[model samples]
Target: MNMDIKEIDGACHCGTVRLRVRLSDGLNSARRCTCSYCRMKGAVAVSADLGGVDVLSGADALAIYQFNTMSAKHYFCSKCGIYTHHKRRSNPNQYGVNAAILAGVSPFDFAAVPVMDGINHPSDHAGGPRVVGTLRFVASPGE
Candidate 1:
């Protein structure tokens, strides 16, 4: 859970798919998108260069899914049906690895995550992306 970590290992819920990822900006790149696919998939993703991720195991068990523009390629664990990572559509040179899959990480780790205006993608318009809203996490008094 150290923010200084630049590289980390990850796995799907079933551990069928494993990955060794070199983060582009440690955990600071973690974010959420308001796009149709991303909104529903609901994983807080962190940025990684195209070559930053290495499938350490169960590569064959990884299934890829693409939609609409077919630019981003979302990878999931075929066996456990857990989302692992995806080739980013906005920036093809990067991948958005599911933060929850990373060791000692959780969706609630961040106090607030900026929600990008994916409904109006930058590629679809001249202006760049905007923050539509913020997703916040407030922990209870006790466990």
Candidate 2:
């Protein structure tokens, strides 16, 4: 591990599963996806290498979910139902870490996040990459 790489600790909501992620690019790689499933889950993900994450415990408590082309493998805690990470479909060599699960990241920290064009994925479309929009989630009480 290089000096720039920082280790972050995280777990499921119920603390059933624990994780230690080696963030090579810190949190700067965080971005949002607009894929059908991703849009529904609404999580901002950060990039990580295949070897960056270690499931410290409760491996059996993790459940895998895959849909559509099934290239991206989404993992969540079966007990608490918290999405921890996923294997990238665009780049199988890399993994997408749940930015919300990483240490020190707050929901208010992000004012806007770039949404990827997962609807017309590069793998399935000929037009290449696209960004849908900058997503905002902040809201006041009772609208």
Candidate 3:
């Protein structure tokens, strides 16, 4: 991918929730996590600072979900149940926005994405974060 685009506009599936964000490192910071919550949600996220994301519309329609340590705040569209972004538990200063929701972007855009060891989160461990594996996308024979 280009990795040059810094700002992106996005919305949930229902379009009731819209947002704009300035990526912390363009799309080069995109990645996935292995925690139980992340494993089930299965979103490829890109980094953004806490102040980088702005709710452009329907802020009241956005829903938040937190669990376990409750350090991370996951946001989604209550109407569509589409995950939009989350205040990163690994780095409270950063928010991991759903890459799939970004305009002109998709999880399949990357051939492979690094999978972080969210199961052994840095806050719970002595060492830093680890990359457990890579999630790869192999397109079918034809479109």
Candidate 4:
């Protein structure tokens, strides 16, 4: 079956955090991390090369939270505390949008999505795994 994918609008439950992202081609194609915060939040992360995601509104409404190695920049809504997305510590240029944040995207094939070894991260980072695997997109207005 050939399914047409398009840019979908997304936001936090509170509407404080808003985003625009092109859907990934398949289901369960997002990465699940075992890292501390990722485990806690249970975030299913789908990343674009470096420019795929667009933050449409509420830049001021979003808050940046950093911890541990201080490399990853975790972005959440200040009022709702919903983590919308993050920038990789290994690759600051790329944006990792929480697949859960995207509205209308299916999770039917979620189990098929690859589970990346983010627990032992820099090793994966150094080998260019992050850059090699995904389709990169051009940055839109609010990115």
In TM-score terms, which candidate is top?
A: 3
Candidate 1: give the clashing pairs: none
Model 2 score (lDDT): 0.82
Clashing pairs in 3: none
- lDDT, candidate 2, at 1: 16
The positional error of residue 87 in candidate 2, measured at the CA in angstroms, is: 0.4
How many clashes (backbone N, Cα, C below 3 Å) per candidate? 0, 0, 0, 3
Angstrom error at residue 62, model 3:
0.8
Per-residue lDDT of candidate 2, residues 1-143 (tens digit)? 12244778877788888899987677766678878888888888877889998999999999999999989999999988999999989878778888778667754577777878988887887777678788787878895
Using lDDT as the measure, the top candidate is 3
Per-candidate TM-scores read 0.97, 0.86, 0.97, 0.73
lDDT of 4: 0.68
lDDT of 2 at 80: 86
Task: Evaluate all candidate structures by whole-model CA lDDT and list the values in order.
Answer: 0.93, 0.82, 0.94, 0.68
* Model 4, runs deviating above 4 Å: 1-6, 23-29, 106-109, 123-143
Error of 1 at 24 (Å): 0.4
Residue lDDT tens for model 4, 1-143: 22344466779879877888764443233676667787788777776555667788888989998988888889999988989888887568666777767787533435345555567776444564432232233456795
lDDT (tens digit, per residue) of candidate 3 on 1-143: 67878898999998999999999899999899999999999999999999999999989999999999999999999999999999988899999999999999999999999999999999998888999999999999995
Q: Give per-residue CA lDDT, model 1, range 1-143, as digits (tens).
A: 57667999999999989999999999998789999999999999999999999999999999999999998899999999999999987888999999999999998989898899888987789877788899999999995
TM-score ranking from best candidate downward: 3, 1, 2, 4
Clash-forming residue pairs, model 4: 28-109, 28-110, 28-113
